[model samples]
Target: MGMLNTLLQAVSSAPIGGAIGAGIAAIGAGIGIGMIGKSACESIARQPEAASDIRGSMILTAAFIEGVCLFAVIAGLLAVLK
Candidate 1:
């Protein structure tokens, strides 16, 4: 019981969890963007004439993912502050 209580206290007192959350969010964002880029490239390869359209859509999707990541990072930081 004492050991368990000590473990709980350590976990609650640490701020590193929030930082880890932020890092995970950033990694997810990178993966999301990479997938978009890969799909765009494949699409452009299959349809050369629609390269511009595919590229534009990919950029838009990546931007949205980035925005979401930014929000997640901010939330994580807020958690750390609290």
Candidate 2:
């Protein structure tokens, strides 16, 4: 238990921890966006006539994912600064 606590403290105290967390979060967001784009492309290829609708949905989903990632970065910054 003591060792675990020490490890936790060390991680929380590291100067680059927050930045690393933010970077990881951004990576996740990027992956999500990539997947969305891939799916959208596949969908359009399968049904060319529905390209517009697929694009619209993909844009909306990407925007939402970006928003969440932005919020997480802000929160991480705030926590680190505090």
Candidate 3:
């Protein structure tokens, strides 16, 4: 019980933990966008004639990912500010 209490207190008092969490979320978003780009490129390369369609779809998907990331960042900021 003592060890559990100590661990809980440490977590509650930790600085930069929120920032660390935000950074991790951002990293995940970056990876997701990178994968989308890679897949789009591969699709375009395999079907040169459909490059336009692939690009359009890719942009839409990337935008949605970016929106989610932005929302997360705003939420993180609000949490920290509060």
Per lDDT, the best of the predicted structures is 1
Candidate 3 structure quality by residue, lDDT tens digits, 1-82: 9999999887765445656666777988999999999999999999999999999999999999998988877776665555
Model 1: per-residue lDDT, tens digit, 1-82?
9999999988786567888899999999999999999999999999999999998999999999999999989988987887
Each candidate's TM vs. the true structure?
Answer: 0.81, 0.79, 0.78
Ranked by TM-score from best down, the candidates are: 1, 2, 3
- Candidate 2: where is the Cα deviation over 4 Å? 1-15
| Candidate 2 vs 3: which has more lDDT | 2
**TM-score-better candidate, 2 vs 3:** 2
Q: Assess candidate 3 and give its TM-score to the true structure.
A: 0.78
Give lDDT per model, in order.
0.91, 0.90, 0.84
Give the range of the ten consecutive residues with the poorest summed lDDT in model 1.
10-19
What is the clash tally of candidate 1?
0
Question: Worst ten-residue run, lDDT, model 3?
Answer: 12-21
Per-residue CA lDDT of model 2 for 1-82, tens digit only, reads: 9999999988778646777787888999999999999999999999999999999999999999999999888777776776
Model 1 stretches with alpha carbons more than 4 Å out: 1-11
Model 2 gets an lDDT of 0.90
